[model samples]
Target chain A: MSKPVIAIDMGGTKIKIGIVQGNTVLSSDSIDADSGSGLRKRLPFIQKAVEDLLDREGISLAEITGLGMASPGIIDSIQKKILSIDKKFGDAPGIHLEEWCLQTFNLPFSIENDARSALWGEWKYGKAKNFDSAVIMTLGTGIGSAAIMDRQLLRGKHFTAGILGGHSVINYKGIHCNCGNKGCVETEASTWNLTSIARSDKNFAESPLAHAPAIDYELIFNLAQEGDAAALHIREQSVQVWSACAINLIHAYDPEILVLTGGIMASSSQIVPYIRKHIETHAWTPWGKISIEEGEFPDTAALLGIAHLVGN
Target chain B: MSKPVIAIDMGGTKIKIGIVQGNTVLSSDSIDADSGSGLRKRLPFIQKAVEDLLDREGISLAEITGLGMASPGIIDSIQKKILSIDKKFGDAPGIHLEEWCLQTFNLPFSIENDARSALWGEWKYGKAKNFDSAVIMTLGTGIGSAAIMDRQLLRGKHFTAGILGGHSVINYKGIHCNCGNKGCVETEASTWNLTSIARSDKNFAESPLAHAPAIDYELIFNLAQEGDAAALHIREQSVQVWSACAINLIHAYDPEILVLTGGIMASSSQIVPYIRKHIETHAWTPWGKISIEEGEFPDTAALLGIAHLVGN
Candidate 1:
């Protein structure tokens, strides 16, 4: 039997690590990363975290075949380096992720952009299986998407092709994105964009949601379901924007299925059907139907994806 | 030395046939084609048109390495069949393109969606050769697009990926497309959609454009240049929509260079600068600047693209 692989997903706020064999999770652990801490300070914490997991599980590091690391930034998988960290983590671009793994465990490591890793996971072992082409979207703090075409990841020359589909424009005259593009789908509908979307509403001043200091899609979705008119309007508009973005992905990647993940899609009961119906009505797919499905892997999709990457 | 290839471009209004070798046209001919005449009837005309070129150029069929065909509609290059004719040639999907070529000249042939083929031509031999990731948008009868990723053509599982980028929605409540989608880029700004767009304008009744029987973009652009208020408004709005679409492609495809091709780009002196300025201000690429340029192949880009496909 093949040894299990370690999969690690490094997010802006947390780290999720798992021991995975094929599609099943053998063992897993999570920790609050507090990425605001500088890279140097975080290094020892990461080492301790992995060591603690092995101790708790009573597993030897020698039993691990490899490690797959998914991080939130532009990643050069070839070099195992984060190319641009942006605002997610300080000095991430300078870190040698492979070198760290080599020194610690003497294991081969592969790293990738979080969205791409999630897509790799989903396509290999989750809902996107059996499809030659698929696009996985994570709709959270920022919208992230990745395309798998002909059963291979469609990373462009700069490793930034289909992954940027979420930033596709849905409203030309809408708000500006942190990426500097005006009216991007992420700018109009993502969790990061939702606070302003809620604040811009006329009923925001009178709604119960106004009392909440912080707002996210979950709050908006729950409030809308509870009959908050302001929340309902934002929710509907957000649905439309997300649907448009979905259609754009459909058009851009021509995938057989779209697997939607991210923290926000925990409300997939609302999002999947809405996007599916909108696409059914407005999307142009004369050949056949395009399926919009919820992602089976949630927070751990990327981590699990690392296992698939390493195993494959 | 390999002999020159025969390239044919079938359009809604005209069919262009030429002998092309390394971007140089040794001989070329054009014939008016009414696509509404139906595909079965047009085949004889198209074949005869090409044969006429063979006669005029005195080039033997054996000397021609292969024939490359570009047509407006969805194409299954693998099957060598037109998938969806898009109302231009309703019977095209039923026609056997490869079989037709085999029976006619015992020659192997390749067919591609016109927009995609144009990008291929340009990427392989024309202005877009420098960039590995690029998008080509053709703004003619209908807005069409093709993308190149890591120097390979991006045809997703459904063979619809990069080809449908123009169908992306710019306004949630914009015009309806013939493709059963509402608020499509094609619906808002294309030769086929121009009539409805102009008719919906509030000032259409009062404008001098109403007096003109034909209201194509040429007249709109000329009138706008002459400071016609309504024309200028429409022009500005079209530019905004096109710019927004370009930004969407830039974000979606992550191309360092975006090549705008089509009949409209013939007036590139105006369109190139407008799109470049808008993209510079609106597009988000933190790494460096994105270069926006016009297609040097003009209308023949798609026809030449067929040869590239066959060579591949």
Candidate 2:
């Protein structure tokens, strides 16, 4: 049998590291992250985390195939390098993860954007497995997406293809996104912009949500369920933004299926069906209707994907 | 390379027929079109056009490699079938162009979306020849686009992949489009919607443009050059829409070069520089800048592209 692999899914707030074989994550560990600091400073911490996880799992470095990383940046997997990052991982573009792995673990390495990695995870073992072409949307603090066209992950020149749905402008006259574009899907509806969108609403001053300890989709969904007017408005508006995003992705990728995942989907019970109806009504797919489904694996998907990447 | 090829570029208003070898069009002809009437009625006319062209060029049927068509619809080129179309070409989906060619001229044939065919034409023989990856935008009565990612044409599962840019919603809350979307790039700024967009402007009733014979980009560009406020406003808005569209295409396809074409680019002197400036200021591309160039051929690109398709 082939050896197990080490997978690292690095997000803005947390870094999830795990040992994975086949489709299952054997054991995992997490580290709170602060990307504002350059990536070089965190190398030793990551090394220790991996070492400790292996020790706790009673596995050795020699017993694993390699290490793979799912990071928040543009990546060139073949060259095993991070191409760029957004105000984070300051030293990443200049650092070669493969060289780091060779020097430290003396093993092979691979890396991809976290969303694209999760797409592989979904396609090989979850909601996207049955569809030959699929679009994966991860609604979280930010909107992250990846697309599979004809069963092949689209890694365009510069490796930005099929991964920039969140950054696509769904509203030309709406708001300015930090990415320099106006009214990107993420700018209009993602969790990172949720509070601003709520505050800018005319109903905000009278809404109960204005005084909440912390604002998030879970709280928003709960308040909206209780018939809070501001919460309801926010929910309605957010879903529309996401639905519009769905239509945009459908037009751009022409996928057979769209897989929805990420933390914001905790409200999937409210979000999924609404998006389904919206697409049926508003999208221009004359060939046929596309199916929308919620994803099964949330926490472990990128890790599983990384394991698969290392195997290849 | 071995022999010449027959090419047909069928547009909403014109059908251009030509004989091409390598990078040059040996001879060409055109016929006015009214696509509101179905495509089947014009088959004989097209057949005669090809026959007369070949006769005048002193070329026999056996002198060409094959025949290819650039049509305005979704197509399965390998299957040599038109899969779907707009309101026009009601009978296209039911007919096989390859079979028609075989029966009429004993030749093999292939068909592709006109925008996609033009992209191939540009890639092989025109503006996009220098880049391995590119996005071609035809700005005219509509905003049609096709992307080449990593030197391969991206024909998605339904063959709708990069061809639906005109339908992508750039403004979810703007006006409703005929394709069942809201504020599509075409709805916001294409030639078909130009009059309506102008008619809705607050300046319409008082402006001299209110008395124009018919409203179009050429008049708008000319008036704007003469400092007509409404025309200046329309020109600015149209260019911005096209620029946002360029960003959307860039984010969607991740191409290194973007080639602009079509009749609307008659105002390229005004549109190209504005879009180029907008992208530099607002696009999120961090690796490097994308080059934008005007296409070399206006009337012959899709035909050239079809020629290359049949040659292959």
Candidate 3:
């Protein structure tokens, strides 16, 4: 048996830490982050959270093999450093995370972008297992994506290759993205921009969707189910954008299977089939059809992936 | 000294064959291909052409290392066979190219998609020679692309990953592509579809562009320079489409340099600057800016690339 591993998923609003061995989580904890102050101010809090979890589990640092971190930004895995954070944790790139780990735990550490880590986790232990090539799209506040090709995670020259699938332009003349690109899939359909996209529709003021307490995919889906015309139109438009994104990813990565995850997949029953139909109709795959499926292990995927990274 | 290699670039309208020694072409020949008759019908003609070229160069079968072929469409390089041809040569994929080469000359052979082969040629001997990681976009009748990452050509699981950059959707609601995808950069901006795109412009009928004898980028560019309003609008739209394609490639491959080539680049003075400016503004390269430049050796890139492939 190998020593247990410590895994950290540093998300935008919350930090999830786990003490894991193989597929089992021995102890886990979560804490809300001060998103306004950024990661530098929250590092000590994260350290305390990890230490507390280890103590509660009756485990010591000596028994821990290493730590694995999954962060939401460009990560240089080889350097165990965050290369850049996209507006979320502004100060993260300035901190030497590897040095912090070395001085605190006296153990080796590995880190990867959260989405890529989730892909690794899924490929190693969940839905993507047994597949040599696959792509995963996490549909949430913004779309996040990662691709695995021929069993190798495609970290390009600048560590920006596979992680930017969400930024691919689906509508050249559409709105601008914070990432500097225009008409990105995220700008068209992601949760962060959903309200703007919905309100921009000419029928919003006259539709039932305007009266909803909060605008979200869940509400839109329910409204669409109830036969709200504007809701149906918005749902169809969002689905088309998502489907276009799926086909773009299919063309770009040439994956055998595409795994869809994240918050919006609460409507996967509808989104999955819709994307599958679009890919079937639009994508030019000569070998055979690419399989589209919902991802398993959404919350724990990055944790599991980090554990694998540290353990290996 | 290495033995000279026979390189063949099987293009849509013409076949270019060459006797190459390293970076230098000792002798070369060209013949118009009967594109209507298909590749299988022209195999004998191609073989005879190669034989005649070798004879003219006073080279025997034993003196030549091997034959390297650069063909359009999906190619199984390991098998040395064309996997699928889009429309140019319908019967190409059915022929056993390697077996034919072996039977004819008893020599080892290698083949690659023309775009990929051209990329290899550029990386090995042309404008992209200095860059370890780069992408090449050949913009002509249609857009074609290939990428090299971390010094290795990116041939994905299905052999379609990096080569489908042109087919990426730029306008989801735009026109349909023959490849089944809608709003592809190729469909929106390529020469094969340019006339249709121009014809669809709202002001095309009112502008001088409608009276032009032929509809092509060259004519449109000349008209735009001469202050034709519709031509200028179309030119701007095409530039934006091409620029969007550039950003998409940069996001997909994460290369240090992007080489632009093909007949369309005859207007490199305008196209190059437009794409460069767009990438500089739109692409998110945290490490550094990606360099965009024109490709060298437009006509003989694949020949040199194939020579390098077979010689090695």
Candidate 4:
């Protein structure tokens, strides 16, 4: 039998680490991260967390084949390097991630962008096992996505192809995204930009949500369910944006199945069916129908995906 | 090459067939096509044209390893089948294209959608050869596009991926596309839809182009250069729509190069630079810049691309 593997999921607020023998998660640990401080500092903090887990579990470093890390940045997987860092992780690009792994555990390792890694996880052990071509979209602070085409991750020539699905324009004249493009689906709707769109509405001054210090999809869905007019309006609008984006994905990628996952999908009971219905009506697929499913593994998909990566 | 291949590009107006040895077109013939007559009638005409080319060039059918044909539709490349038909083709899905080719020539045959085949031609021989990842947008009667990712054609799971670039939503509330989607890039800016969009603008009533029998980008570009107010207004709008769509491709596919080729790109002096400027300013690629260029072979790209398929 092959040895177990370690998988790490690096996130903005929390870090999820786990051990997997095959498709099943053996044990896992979670910790709050000072991600705002930048990944350079977070690396040592993560090292301490991994070492503690290994010692507590009484597992030797040698028994662990290697580590699979899912991170938020443009990744040069072949070179095992991070290419760019967004605002969340300030100094990630310069971090010597591979060297750090080699020095710490003396093992080979692989890393991929978080969404792409999550796709790997889902394809390997979760919802998409039987599929070869699939598009995975994570509707969170910003929309994140990755595509698997013909059994391979479509990194493109610039390592950006499958990773930039969120930046697709759903409305050409709607709003300008931080990515500098106009009317991106993420700009129109995402947990990060949801409040701004709500404030722009004419009814915001008298709305109940105006009283909240910060806004997110959770509060929006909750308030909408409670029959708040402004919240309901925003919720419907958000759903349209996501639905339109999903339709675009269906047309652009031509996948047999589309996987929807993310923190925003916590209210998926309201989101998934709505998106599925919209794509059914709006998408122009002539051959057959495409199945849209709520992602089964939330945080654990990439973690399991990493374990599979290490095995390979 | 292992063996010379026969490549055919079938369009609504003309069919071009030739013997292609590597990137060069050896013996070629262009025949007018009466697409209104339907596929059953068009096939014999095309077959005679191919036969004439073979006889005139003194190329033996036995020496041809395979045949490749490019048409406008959703295609199953693996099965060498055409899966759908647009209005111009009358009805094509019922035809057994591969079977006919195999029986007629006693050789294996392959077929693909025209836009994708054009992209393959460009990647194999034209301007896109320098870049492994690229997007080719053909703005003719309607907009068509093909994407090459990591040096391979991205057929997606359902043969829909790159072929749907024209249907990208540029303006959410702009116009209704024939495909059931609203405000698609093609509906707003392609040659087929440009006349309607221009007619909707109030200024078009007074423009020189309004007097033309058939309005197209060629007439609009000409009138815009001569300082017609309505033509200039529509020209600017078309440029913006194309630019927005280009930026969308830059974000969605993250290709290193975007090759613009089509009947409309005859005015590429205006279109290519405008798209390049917009993408350079609007896209959020920190890796570097995306290069936009007019394709070296506009109409013949698909024909040459068919040769690449046969060679493969």
Q: Which stretches of candidate 4 lie over 4 Å from their true place?
A: A55-62, A104-107, B1-6, B18-21, B26-33, B51-67, B102-109
Over 4 Å off in model 3, which ranges? A103-107, A208-213, B103-107, B207-213
Candidate 1 iRMSD, 1 decimal? 1.5
Candidate with better TM-score, 3 vs 4: 3
- Compute the lDDT of residue A240 as modeled in candidate 1: 87
As for TM-score, the candidate ahead, 1 or 4, is 1
- Per TM-score, the best of the predicted structures is 2
**What TM-score quantifies how close candidate 1 is to the native fold?**
0.94
lDDT of 2 by residue, A1-312 (tens): 457999999887788899998898989998877777878878888899999999999999999999999987678888888887766677889876788888999988989888999989999989889788999888987788899988889888888888888888888877988677888998998877788888887888888778977788898899899998888988998898889888888999999889999888988999999999999998877779898998869888888887898898
Considering TM-score, which of the candidate structures 1 and 2 is the better prediction for this target?
2
After best superposition, candidate 3 residue A27: deviation in angstroms? 3.0
> Which runs of model 2 end up more than 4 angstroms from their true locations?
A94-96
Superposition error at B29 for model 2 (Å): 1.7
User: Could you tell me the TM-score of chain A in candidate 4?
Assistant: 0.95
Worst 10 residues of 4 chain B by lDDT: B84-93
Model 1, residue pairs in steric clash: none
Quality class of the docking in candidate 1, CAPRI style: medium
Residue pairs with colliding backbones in model 2 are none
For candidate 2, write residues B1-312 as lDDT tens digits: 558999998887788999999889999998876777778888899999999999999999988899999988688877878887766677888876778899998998888999999999899888898687999999987789999987889888888999988887788787987677787899999888899999988888877789998988899899899998888889888888888788889998999998999988988999899999989988877779999999878778899888888888
Separate DockQ for every predicted complex: 0.71, 0.78, 0.81, 0.66
Tens-digit per-residue lDDT, B1-312, candidate 1: 346887888877788888877666678888776878777787777688778888998888888888888888778888888888778889888878788888987888888888888998888778889687888888888888888887788777757778886789887767678887777787778788787778777888878788889888888888888888778888888888888889878877888788898876656676888899988887756567887888878878887787667655
lDDT of 3 at B191: 85
RMSD after Cα superposition, model 2: 1.9
lDDT per residue for candidate 3 within A204-252, as digits (tens), equals: 8987777767688898888889887778988898898888888878888
